[model samples]
Target: MRFEGKVALVTAAAQGIGAAVARRLADEGASVVVTDLQEDKLGEVAAGIGARALPLRVDVTSRDDVDAAVAAAVERFGRLDVVVNNAGGCIVQSAPEDTTDDDWRAQLDLTLVGASRCIQAALPELVKNRGNVVTISSVNGLAAFGNIEYSAAKAGQIAMTVNYAARYGSLGVRFNVVAPGTIRTPNWDNQPDTLERLSKMYPLGRIGEPEDIAAAVAFLASDDAAWITGHTLPVEGGVLTGPTVLNPALSKKEYPGH
Candidate 1:
């Protein structure tokens, strides 16, 4: 129970990685405030976690909603020790040349500024508790994975973490990022063939699970990483080493006879 008395607020906690992170924290004894726009799904997540969880409908793009959620978390949990900024996702669908100014704004607003709002809202409580933040970035931010707008927004998150870590270290707070490779989330549920093909690109022989990311968040949020900060831990199953698709024969597991 690393988080025995700690309280955590996780954004986008309706499902996938957010849900997993909330559950992981609750399992380790943290009172979790789960926020997402999906009210029904958020309720289910809170129910599963029982009395330790509080579900709230929060639209990260709205400052009012973000502020309200933070206030609600403190009111119910009495304190906030960790903020998991998992509220962002890729929303742009146009090609780079076709992407508009609105597309850029929308992507950055949710993925980048949205995180900032949460951190801002909880800064007071976090400072009082010597708390930390773990942002869910993406391997796309670290490398060229095709979605230009999304990748840029995700990269902004990494940059934000580094700066926040530097600015707040003296205040007893820390910030870090988890850049994950393609995970088995609902976002990819309709793209089974795409996921299967992408799995081969990973050196680990499979894509990541939400729990895999949750474990990293737990460590970064807990005292175990007391000396760690301003770092981007890529929990990407070695995909960053290089995608196996580039040279199939090089992967013995994927091409045994080669």
Candidate 2:
């Protein structure tokens, strides 16, 4: 077990990437604390991880909740070695001109400020234990991929990570960002063939799975990446390298091969 005797706290652990990360960490021998606003779903996720997980209800937007959750984690595990800031979402998807002040605020609060609060609350224990942090950013954050508000906030997260690394490296704490590109999750459930369509956007010819992001998080959280800090690792399936061609269906002419 690479993480034997280690303690980890993962925010937004109810489903998707967060759930996968929680399970991966627990499997690697870490006692993990899983937190989310979805109490029932969070409980189920924690239970599925077996006894090594402690489930907590946390509204990351609330400093009180974030602080209490960190306190609970330390009280239960005695120490904290890693904190995964995976709790964020695109609250509203709209064109830049149509986006409202509330939309921008919500996105920033949840995706950016919320992560900051978690990092802040977990800082003391992390500093004391020489812990590390891994934040979940998006490809949109690194590029003009759309989702204006969400993308902006996610970019801010990346900035925050680099700054944290620079400021806390002396304190024995490391920080990194994981930018995922079109990960296949429940969010796309209602859209027909969404995964297949999105797969065309990646050079790998397939969209990423939650485990893909989880693996990256685990690497950055472990000693394997001890020398790595102030880095934004794009876990995207080569999407950031180049642009994909337009959809074949949208083409006016088809090649002779078909």
Candidate 3:
């Protein structure tokens, strides 16, 4: 029960990595406020967590909604100690060169500025409680993974975390980021073949699960990482080590010396 009396607010908690993070925190004794635009799914998540979870509908793009959720969290939980900015996703559909100004604005607004709004509204309480933030970025941000807009926004998250950690370290607060590789979520329910093909690209022989990301978030949010801050921990399955297929012999489990 690392979070015995701590309170956490997780955005985009209806499902996927968000829901997993909320449950992980609650399981460790934190009162969690789970926010998402999907009211019904959010309710289910809260229900599973029982009395420790509060479900709220929040559109992170809207400042009013973000502010209201923060206010509601303090009111319901009495205090807030952690903020999980798990709200962003890739919403752009246009080709990179064909992408319009509106596409760029929409992507950045939801994925980047949305995180800023949450931090702004919750800063007061966080400062008072010596809280921290764990943003859900992506391995796409650290490398060129095709989706240019999404990768840019994810990279911005890492940058934001570093800057926040620097400015707030004196105030007893910290900020960190978890950049995940492809995970099995509802977003890819229809892409089983894609996941299978992608799995081969990972050194671990499988893509990540939401629980994998949650474990990292739990560690970063807890006192276990007290001395850690301003870091981007990539939860990718060694894909960041470069393509293993380039040298097929390197992909084998045994070496000639062994």
Candidate 4:
């Protein structure tokens, strides 16, 4: 009941990590506004979470969409206490030589600009509530991944988190980034070797689950993390610890075990 009367807005809440975070927040008594580009899917997610959800079709890339969603949240919930900017996605494949200008721009807009819009729109209310903002960044934000543009944008998110914390820390608003390694979601299931490869990459010997990230978000949103801010936390299964070796199939012959 950490969030007993708090109002939270979570973007990209139709499924995957966003859905998991929204449900977890709602279960702890927050009035959650679930936003996504898919209206029907958003509604279904909200319904499954029970009564404390307001569903909205939102395209985080658009300023109008983000502004309207923030307005809707304030209007419906009376006051906003937390916002989880979880809308970014890696929407395209990249081969450096073949990547188009537009394709690269799209990824930047989705990952960096979209998060900026949410943070800007939610700034006023969060300041008023003395609340928090959590951005769902990627491990690529901290280190590097092969996807050049995507990694750059995610890295921007981490910088934004730090800058926001610096700017708003005095006003009692908190901001942080949660960088998840590979997680077991709908997308992961589709990857041919991601499961095996990711398991090998982590010292924990497994890919992450959605709930793992959700728990971290919930804590950051709550008073439990009142003293914490401006950090890019690696929610990966110890991926940042060192080079890991997968077993039997994908990993090397000898490696540290989880």
Task: Give the TM-scores of the predictions, in the order they appear.
Answer: 0.95, 0.93, 0.96, 0.92
Model 2, span 79-192: residue lDDT tens: 999999999998887778988899888999999999999899989998999999999999999999878888899999999999999999999999999999998788888875
Candidate 4 C-alpha RMSD relative to the actual structure: 3.4
Candidate 3 clash pair list: none
Superposition error at 33 for model 1 (Å): 0.3
For every candidate, C-alpha RMSD to the true structure in Å: 2.6, 4.0, 1.8, 3.4
Order of all candidates by lDDT, from best down to worst?
1, 3, 2, 4
lDDT of each: 0.94, 0.92, 0.94, 0.89
If the candidates were sorted by their TM-score against the true structure, best first, what order would they fall in? 3, 1, 2, 4
Evaluate model 3: give its TM-score: 0.96
lDDT of 3 at 86: 99
Residue-wise lDDT of candidate 3 within 74-99, one digit each (tens)?
A: 89889999999999999998899999
- Backbone clash total for model 4 is 1
lDDT of 4 by residue, 1-258 (tens): 999999999999998999999999998999999999888889899999877899999998899999998999988889999999998888768687888999888998998999989989998999999999999999987786778788888999999999999999999999998999998877766785868876878877888999999999998888999999998778998888767643234444454452
Task: Please count the clashing residue pairs in each candidate, in the order shown.
Answer: 0, 0, 0, 1
